[model samples]
Target: MSTLQSQSKIEEANKELVRSFTRTVFVDHRPDRAVEFFDPKGKWHGGNFGTVEGAQNIAGLLTAVVGGLPDIRATEQDIIVKDDTVVVRLVVEGTHKGNLLGFPATNRRVRWDAIDMYKIKNGKIMDDWASEDGVKILADIGAYTPPWMKSGN
Candidate 1:
């Protein structure tokens, strides 16, 4: 295939991969497919410390955390694709219906803006870095109590 054609195909695959990740992660809450998009031993950086290796590890971690949110949605705001990577900027909206990160459900609406960069290898994702504005969501849900909020000396 010509260089231009190859680039186009890569771009399309990157976009689809990003979309699939969004669907599985935020919409369907299915984590079994994470390795299908990530390297089996890939290391994820930015805003998180967990190292996920293999699809089973990724699936188990996600499944454990996903049950907290009964309603969740992610909307892609923009996507930029290069020769071997795709960057997706999105906003996630959800309502807490169960405990998460030790915080009980407050039944409040929350939103977070995030950007994820996925590196593709052989038309499959190899690794990813994600940055998210999680503090905003915590503040929106009244779960983040600032020291300034405390009264009395």
Candidate 2:
């Protein structure tokens, strides 16, 4: 195979892998199940809480989120792949059934937008930057209290 053909093959493989990861890990109830798809030094950056490295740490985070949104589903709205980079936009839908961020379960169904960018290396995802609208989620679950509604404010 030629060099261009090899690169094209790699990109195709990466695209397929990302789609599988989305459905099996992000969409399904078990994000950690895609452990093999991540590099040993893989890092998932959540912006505020810092980077989460290692499969175990990522799994813990996923598990915690699932604790609150027991029926979470990450429905991929768009996926773009190029070379070693993959970008995905997801509509995360879930139901509040357990405490989250110190708020009691409200049994509310929520749909939130999430975008994730991944750096693929050696056929594994070595880095990820993820962003989600959190304040909106809290409000959807009736967890956010306005300053005017607070006792001291």
Candidate 3:
């Protein structure tokens, strides 16, 4: 096969890996699959949680998220694959079923959105950056009050 063909195959495999990572981590909540998706020294970033590295840490985090949102589901909006990068847009929904961020379950339904970009190397996800609408989620669940709104109270 030509070099172009080989590159195409690699890109396709990377895209599939990103998709499986999303489904496993956010949809199916498979801890083992989370480990399979990320490289041993993989790095991931989310707001406030700081940087998490290594497959075992990522797997533990995914497992904790599954516990926090037992019915959470990610509705994929778009996917773009180019070179070693794959970006996915998703709308997430779930019920407040367990403790999260030091708050007890409010039993409310919450909808949030996030975009995740993964950097693939040798078919393993090497790095990821995820941006999620955390403030909206916190406000929706009554866990947070906007600064401006707090001044009015």
Candidate closest to the true structure, highest lDDT: 3
Q: Provide the TM-score for each candidate, comma-separated.
A: 0.82, 0.86, 0.90
The residue ranges of model 3 lying beyond 4 angstroms of the native Cα positions read 147-153
Q: Please provide, for model 2 over 1-153, each residue's C-alpha lDDT reduced to its tens digit, 9 standing for 90 to 100.
A: 999999889988988877887777656677667577788778889886578998667767777778888888887888888889989898988899988766789999978899999899988888889898877687789878656656877
Per-candidate local distance difference test? 0.74, 0.82, 0.85
**Residue 105 shift from truth in candidate 3, angstroms:** 1.2
Which window of ten consecutive residues has the lowest lDDT sum in model 1?
43-52
Which should have the higher lDDT, number 1 or number 3? 3
Candidate 2: pairs in clash: none
Model 3 score (lDDT): 0.85
Q: Which structure among the candidates has the greatest TM-score?
A: 3
lDDT of 2: 0.82
lDDT of 3 at 86: 94
**lDDT ranking, high to low:** 3, 2, 1
Each model's RMSD to truth, in Å?
3.0, 3.3, 2.0
Per-residue C-alpha lDDT of model 1 across residues 37-92, encoded as one tens digit per residue:
66666656546444566556766665655656667788999999988888999998
lDDT of 3 by residue, 102-130 (tens): 66788888899899999999889999898
